[model samples]
Target: MPSTSISTGSAAGPAPCLAVSGASGKTGWRVVEEALGRGYRVKALLRPGSEVPEGLQGAELIRLELTDQAALERALEGTVALVIATGARPSVDLAGPLKVDALAIRQQCAACRAAGVKRVVLVSSLCSGRWFHPLNLFGLILVWKRVGERWLEASGLDWTVVRPGGLKETEDDLDAQGIRYSGPDQQESNSIPRRLVARVCLEALDAPASIGRIIEVTSAAGVEPLSLEQWLARQPQPA
Candidate 1:
């Protein structure tokens, strides 16, 4: 483990720093954007080959492989929290899910521990852990994602697993869409915009009740909008 620490702030004050992995991806960049918009200083972590997106312009970018323990730890050091938006992409490589969804999550958990980062939020899918799902055809992604979620749960850190339904790229009419959030595998079929997912990730960070919970989300025109805190308040504590 490396002893590197990110500078918090000097003259202004101590602004909490947030590290967002997979920052170049659609969801990752939005998470960074939302974090910055919420007044948190952000460190956007991307792969070396990942093309920098326009959304990451305001944040500090650190390019490194997640498998590089030293670099990962260095990126996470001094950051108050981390949002893991990394997921395996569809490709010819059959092992992509196992490597990215499972192994990489384990690696990130270890790095967070070594870096002294206490808070973590993972972006997973709605049907995660299901063996008979259609999405599992892509390298058993749902299964691997579940494995990753379990590892994070047992990581002994303040963690939240956000499993969203089918992701939509459209950012239009966001205000009209209300998010339906449930506990664990409640809602298996629906869709949500990536922007909404980004907002919930940040919301989970602010809500202490979200820690150690698996929040499943989806959106629609008629669903009533509610903050993560509001929804958490209505649910019974996990036994």
Candidate 2:
């Protein structure tokens, strides 16, 4: 593993509070924990019936349906940024992906606009727009995810899309893995720990250069780890 220290180039002064939606999920909970560890006030938002994971205890929790425009806007109010970790689970219902990945994303973007939350980091998946991938068997999830990403890109908010590769649950040996970060479609298949993905989300929040970019991440032993700032500086800026 490479050195963990990477300059974030964070703006001068105190950081504002952040909101993390889908805080009860595997990756979502970790994002909340990492933000708290970094000394930022956090608001954990969840669906009305979602379980409150033990890891989310320290942060303020709000429960509401993402489809409820008014409630979603209110939950997002006063937060300077939002990290959208919401994702559809595998289900027999074929429309699940369309609703959760696409429609729900549009809802959140509308709420963000109404609530004045300008910064957003969305947890998307690699191969997000592909039509032939096997993952699309789950209701064309990748297609919907791509639709969601497009909505955010056009939302006019300061946004960065973190498209992580296959996620793993193992926390052991994390220090041995270094992240490989690149722009969209640069990498196709690999896996990364949820913890590293969570860290990148926070790092994107701190690094302004991440705005309007789609960053894909995967990790493996012997790869040099670079901070999001370091990686972004090396990419060509959008015209």
Q: How many clashing pairs per prediction, in order?
A: 0, 0
Q: Model 1: per-residue lDDT, tens digit, 1-239?
A: 12222233345777789999989999999999998888889999999999998999889999999999999999999898999999998999989999999999999999999999988999999999999998988999999999999999999888899999999999999999999999888988989999999999998887777888899999999898898889988988776
How many steric clashes does model 2 contain? Answer: 0
* Residue pairs with clashing backbones, model 2: none
Q: TM-scores of the models, in the given order?
A: 0.94, 0.93
Q: lDDT by residue for model 2 over 142-232, one digit each (tens)? A: 9999999999999988888999999999899999999999899988999999999999999988787788889999999999878888888
Model 2, position 43, has a per-residue lDDT of: 92
Candidate 1 CA-lDDT value: 0.91
lDDT of 1 at 155: 94
Off by over 4 Å in 1: 1-12
Query: Lowest lDDT 10-mer window, candidate 2?
Result: 1-10
Number of the predicted model whose lDDT against the real structure is largest? 1
lDDT of 2 at 62: 92
